[model samples]
Target: MRLPLGLTAAAILFVLTMVGGAILDQLNENMHVRYRDASVALERLEHASERISGLLREAVLDRNVLLTVGYDNLNRTLDTTLNNLEGLAESFGLSREVNLLGLRRLELQDIERRCLKLMDEDRWGEARDLLFGEDFALSRKLYEIDTENLVSVLDDRLRREATRFATARQASLGVRGLALILLLTSGVLFSRRLTRELAEQKRLQRELTAARDELEDRVRERTRELEHANRQLASLSYMDGLTQVANRRRFDVAYPQEWDRAVRHGYPLALLMVDVDQFKAFNDHYGHQAGDQCLQAVARVLRDSARRSGDIVARYGGEEFAVVLPGLDTRAAVAVAEAMRWAVESMRREHCVSDCADVVTISIGVATRQPKPHQEPAELLAEADKALYRAKSAGRNRVMVWSGEDVSFYI
Candidate 1:
């Protein structure tokens, strides 16, 4: 009797293993298809990134029309790959990764435009320097490597899920085989064994749920970090690295915005261009190290002097600074310039080689205008520059305001 029961249990176990294997095989095939699709897309994006880099290198190094055309062609291909990546974002439901890719792509486009502009200006060395720069190279590496890793991780996760499913199926088969053996030994034993197997199945389900929840938490945390980094990058872009004030780029952005606002409101807009007196002599006497410190001091004074909500102080290239005054008339803007002069005098940073005085001083040029449809802002800038030149020609430590008349309106 026992021999017959054992034979029956073996027969049932064989059937259970065959069914489990067939189900796992079908699921595994589906997993492979998804993995292949994601990997192929990621690889294509990586290839496009490398091609863009190579094209840029050739265009910059050769400085030929044909190379430039080749570079442009590759840029178009890169744009297409970027679109494909966008589509993949929708397919994978990965909004954060897509957003980062979009940002990187836009930055690359800007770099490309800048390269073209430099080439047009006949600045071959500068254009070559740009492609060899760390910023663009790092940005390309980040986006390509990140996307590739993301695809690999996703594929790995899919593989893991399939493996877990197979493991569970195998475990179930083992339990069923045990139940059959127990039944062959005694009917009561089979019922107890089935009850224990159901409890173990619930335990495994709980483990899987916990793991998925943890993974979701990690994904959300990573998204937050990326957003914070983006904000920081934006802030740094507008700031002057040496002086800690707004840079030329920020001034360019703010100038148009303020001009438009002043035109709409019929308010006065003022611009003050300041030059550190005898800065070249100071640099020559004190050495470059001291020159940097002096500039920082001047920037600090200017920054503190223009403390109003609508006031902007920026480093307008070497040894020159500018203050943007919104909603201020000519007199008010002149007063602001005088205060800035006094602020620099108060710093008392010694410049022995100076023609103006024994200390660091600044000559300021003030220009004010109420915006009109007939006039252009460029005129205001030209007038201010002329006034600055006058201040420098006539003793370097004074303030001169520009009037429509042929001369500077001295203050």
Candidate 2:
């Protein structure tokens, strides 16, 4: 009776193990399908948004009447994409984000209608302004934020599901182990059957291990891809679209971090506020396109001249640049400022309508501080600005250093 009972228990446990393994495998497969689907939907939405923006730009700026067809097609594609995205978001329990995206879509449509009306009136400037204005940018930014939040929520749920799958796998393993112990105890009475069962169990175990390994590999690969995408998004957020360099947002973030580090380490930190001399006149005489090219050239020079690993070059605003030099005293900082000024002048980009010189020139204001725990980063920035003003007042195309009491020309 005991032998038969043990054999029966072993058989039942084996069956349970197999069922649990099958269920876990199915769950993992379903997770993979959902992950892939959500990723595809996001990529499609991003592509559609980019294409729509391009079409709008062409219609307004280039006055390309033919782009109306492209715009209509993109609108249709975007609608389909958004519908798919909303469905996926709802499925992932992200209904709130879906609603937010819907609201953002409506906002974007209202902005688009006004822009199109302006375009029809041949108010290209107003249309262009509206297309690139704060309202349009805010709407687009909100859309991106909503999508990111949706992805984040979905990712967190998938991680929880993965954990549950791991737990189920462990349960399956324990059931299999118990089955093997029962089979061993009953081997004498049912040696032949036990042998066959053991062999079958070994084969199934091998297959299960292989499946788990493959699933884990897939999950790891997906994680790496998501991480890479996040890194790219962060880079794009910090970079200037026009200059291809660090933007003011990046500058705002870095300054305080560097300042804190300088305060902690008892090291000097330098700030350079640089401006293009007579940039407005240059823009009026040479046109905005030329002005853009000139700024790009100047940015390139500033980026190149600040060769230290700790130096940060950023487009502070239109025709203005800022450089953060870590561990540089007033003397070293002034030298770097002078080098930057010379490099821009050497570019010799023609700015004929300037009172300063025949070619484009930059005025730089240098300020260095051994930051204290009580001091703010803005103090250094303000000093640099004052030095920059004095440089411009004295004459353009020179570097000035702030001495706390007065600003003096560096060269």
Q: Pick the candidate with the highest lDDT.
A: 2
lDDT of 2 by residue, 123-210 (tens): 8899889999999999999888877877788889888888989898998989888887787787676777767877887898799799
Show model 2 residue runs off by greater than 4 Å: 1-82, 85-216
Name model 1 segments beyond 4 Å from true. Answer: 1-188
**Native-to-model Cα distance after best TM-score fit, residue 184 in candidate 1, in Å:** 14
Candidate 2, pairs of clashing residues:
none
Using all chains and alpha carbons, the TM-scores for the candidates as numbered come to 0.64, 0.61
The CA lDDT of each predicted structure is: 0.77, 0.83
lDDT of candidate 2 at residue 101, scale 0 to 100: 72
Q: What is the lDDT of candidate 2?
A: 0.83
